[model samples]
Target: MRTLFIAIASVLLAGMTIMSCEEKDDFVPTLLLDVQDAIQVSNRGGEFSIDVLSNLSWEANTTANWITLEESTGEKGKRALSFSVTENENDERSSTITVHSQEGTQAELTVVQESGLTLNIFVKEGAEGSGKSWEDPTNLSNALKLAITGSSIFIAEGHHTPMNIVSGGNSDDPRDRTFEVASNMTLIGGFPAQASSGATPDPDAYPTILSGELSDGNNSYHVVTISAPQSDEEQVVLRGLTISDGQADGSKSSATIQGRDFRREYGGGLIIGGSRVVLENCAVKNNTSDKYVAGVYVFDEAEVTILHSKLNNNASKSNGGGLWANNSTVFAYHSEFNENSGGTAPAVHAYPNAEIYLFNSEIRDNKGRSFGAAFYARADSKGALVNCLVTGNESTSSNGGGGVMMYDNCEMEIISTTITENTIKGPGGGVYRRKGENILSIYNSIISGNTQKEGTMNIDVYESDADPAKILASTSGEVVFDANGQIEEDAAFKAISMLGDDFTPIGDDNPALTYGMTPNHLKEIDYLFPESEKDWLDQDFHGHDRSGSTTMGATLPE
Candidate 1:
């Protein structure tokens, strides 16, 4: 009996040892995965897979309803698990899929989706609830947090400041909060929504205002800043909005242009850097900066297109008051710059390889303490003025350009533009041509009523190159008026049709009306916004058609 018991014990011990060895040979110490930190994806729902390497059975599960796995349970041995996601129609989302082994070892895989345009993010003032639906609205600062790429945020009709401050030990309006708008997004204002039926979305009637006037006279640095790099081809668009009452004060920044270091605080109303932006039917006014530009500042790689907008009544201590571009481009279509006062160019200033292209716009009633009253442009750059009215500007500083100051080596093409009633305290009432042989091609344009305190540029400096300007008829006179109110040069040129005195179709014959009405006699004119195909304005500045009246100016008679 003792021997039998010993044999049974030995057999049991041998079986137990065999079982332990088998389990040890097939054991996996740790489950390791070779995957990216995060995966970036796009709009539509599609199949995605991830490889899992293990020696046990694994099951995949996700909390997001948009995610669907083809197979939940899998025998893990370096195999790919396929999953599908639904079409996204909201803001950008990040979802994670948790994978678990039979031994309770968990791993996560995350997928990120880009924001879609179908989602509507409505923002109003003084609402502190969830911003999901129209019934519960949020403030602009909160909505900006959810504003990702390719998103559209609708703002309501109220005074929306960038920040709402609460006084405390150190929380008393630091003046650092700004509307840091992202690239490839749209911010449309003038929306009034409550529960269901919002207003008809009239910008003027609703009057959505974005003010930077913080309490206790603590102003923000910038009202709006569009400085993010683009993920797509879409631009940062602001439509039917008003950017006003901003004061860009405090710490100055440094910008380099043409190997020169410029230091100043820039862009009180709007500052654009390394992005494409558009302002449609908007107004940028009542903004102030200690130095640099007050209304708009376009930096490197930035393209700002203003269509049917107004830049008025902004002030700066130096440089541009309305608009300034440095090493970038600014194109305006049917826009107006009026009543901006500053040092240098008050209406518009382009410098250090920047370009300003204005088509069918008006530069009027601006005051500049120095340089050009309408524009101060330096050479090593290019610009154009087509179908524009430059009038009622004054260069307060002595020996400045009344209408425009073209300094150093540069090129500007003036076609079918009217330069009238602009005065300077010094030379170049029409234009101050400095240094090198500047390229000022005044083709088929009118230069009248421009004046300087002394040595007016009407016809005084014909000795300069390309000067005895190729001019058309004028309403009054060029700078210093002559007996005949006409320039001395007789070079006749043809150009595209621009605006008359009131941007009204030429109805009455002015004093310097000398040419005849013939479209075939005009040369082809290069205009801006080639995407619109036909160059000339279908409707004039006031949104009125040019009635078929054969006139003497440069516009094509329909």
Candidate 2:
């Protein structure tokens, strides 16, 4: 019996030893994930981390190109896996980082990066909340501050004045007083609280105004100034606003070159320098400047494009009451310049090395005290006017060229245009070229009813003899010339009236209706048009189809 009990005990001990060995073989550490299901990041790019609660080794990997894991592998026991993302320039994106343990357990952390923000502004109403929607619109001043690059600002209808305090002082500095637009930004006005079916806002229904009403003694400020440097990758756009009441009195100093003090009153309404600016459906009126360009000024290699806009009732003490461009490229299309007064070139003045293009527009009812009541091109400037109308413009000074004045070494081309009813106090009521060898080419155009008060010549090339055939040519239609490109017959307009925000010609017998030849240069320079603009050269200023009978002036008869 003793022997049997010992054998049973030994068997039991052996069994216990085997059970212990099996338990040791099956031993494994537990692994767990302690992190949020998802996380959010800004569009500007940032870093974040996730906590891993595990008793084993873990690894993490990202599934997106923009997202990257900083620490892909980590040890056990509450380890942090870091990750980062790049700046989101296109749109919102999402990615996931999967963290897996050696025990085959896995966890995911979803990351979402947002796109750029767009703000809204309503000056009439108060800003009370975030400016993401119409109901929570902010002020224009605040919206400009909150907006980042590539962001857009939609301004509702109201008169928005500049913030009087910029960088804490109201000094004579333009950067401190004017409304400065940032680079790569789009500012659109004339929007209602809610838009209709159409994507574009109607300027007539929602009249957005930007006024500069702060009277700082005699030193006035410009309404808007764009001095930001723009590249080919980015552009700045300003549209659908009435910019008025700007007053620049030539009191502020711009520079001291050669012991002379230059003024900073070039642009009363807007000044664009070293920027790429586009102005569409805008009205710049009722602005005054003591120097040049009461309406708009472009300088320092700026590229400006103005389309379907109006520049009226602006006054300048010097040149270019409507527009002044110095060493810049300016393209004005389907626009109007009326009732502007200045010392010279009431409608437009182009300085040396400036390139100006005016197409399918009107320059009328303007007064220049010196020369070029309609348009002027200084030395070494290049100007082209296509299918434009220059009429009812007067030059009050003793200089010539009420319709157009081209200085020495300037080049000007007028194609399919009309020049009528312009008066000059000296010579060349229709057109004038200065004494030097300048080029003034007129093709398929008309020069009629222009009077020189104190001179006999209607089109004068002062001391620069020009051949009538070489200087004037026509491809398809007759280039009308009545005694040195001046016709005594009436233009026979239905009415020369400003009728309710519309300039209309009501007569069917107008001479400009049937004498026009569309040139190939119109399509070659079509790149000047904005991306949103359609083929407008085939259309009139009133949006009438010109495929039937192309009109010489800006307007087409219905």
**Which candidate gets the maximum TM-score versus the true structure?**
1
Give the C-alpha lDDT of model 2. 0.69
Per-residue accuracy of model 2 over 1-558 as CA lDDT, tens digit each: 223434544554455445546676664544444434666565667676655665568888887999988998988656777778898876677888888888788878788776654434333333555677666667676766666556777777777777633322345553345566644578888877464333356678989887776544332357877754556755678889898887766665553221122246778888777679889999999999877789988887889888889989999887789988888989988899899999889888888789888888889999888978888999798887766888889988878888889887887877656677789888878788775667777654555557786645556777746544223322111233321345324443222331112433334554455434453433443232243433555666556766755345455555
Candidate 1 wrongly placed segments (more than 4 Å): 1-118, 164-173, 193-198, 254-264, 459-511, 516-534, 537-558
Every candidate's lDDT: 0.67, 0.69
Candidate 1 lDDT over 1-558, as tens digits, reads 223434544554455445546767665423334455465554555677766655567888888888888878777455577888786787778889888898888778788876665556777787776666567777888877676666677777888888732111124335655676643679888776443445456788778888887765767656776764533456789999999887766455533222222233788888777678999999999999888789988877578889999999999988789998988888898898999999898889888788898877889999988888897778677787766778889977875677767777767766556676788878777666676656665544556556776545532332355444334333224221222335435423221123354532233333223342222222343433253523443333333343442232234333
The clash numbers for all candidates, in the given order, read 5, 0
Model 2 TM-score, all chains together: 0.67
The C-alpha stretches of model 2 lying farther than 4 A from their native spots are 1-129, 164-176, 193-200, 215-220, 255-263, 466-558
N/CA/C clash count, model 2: 0
Candidate 2 local Cα displacement, residue 302, angstroms: 0.9
Q: Work out candidate 2's RMSD over C-alphas.
A: 20.0
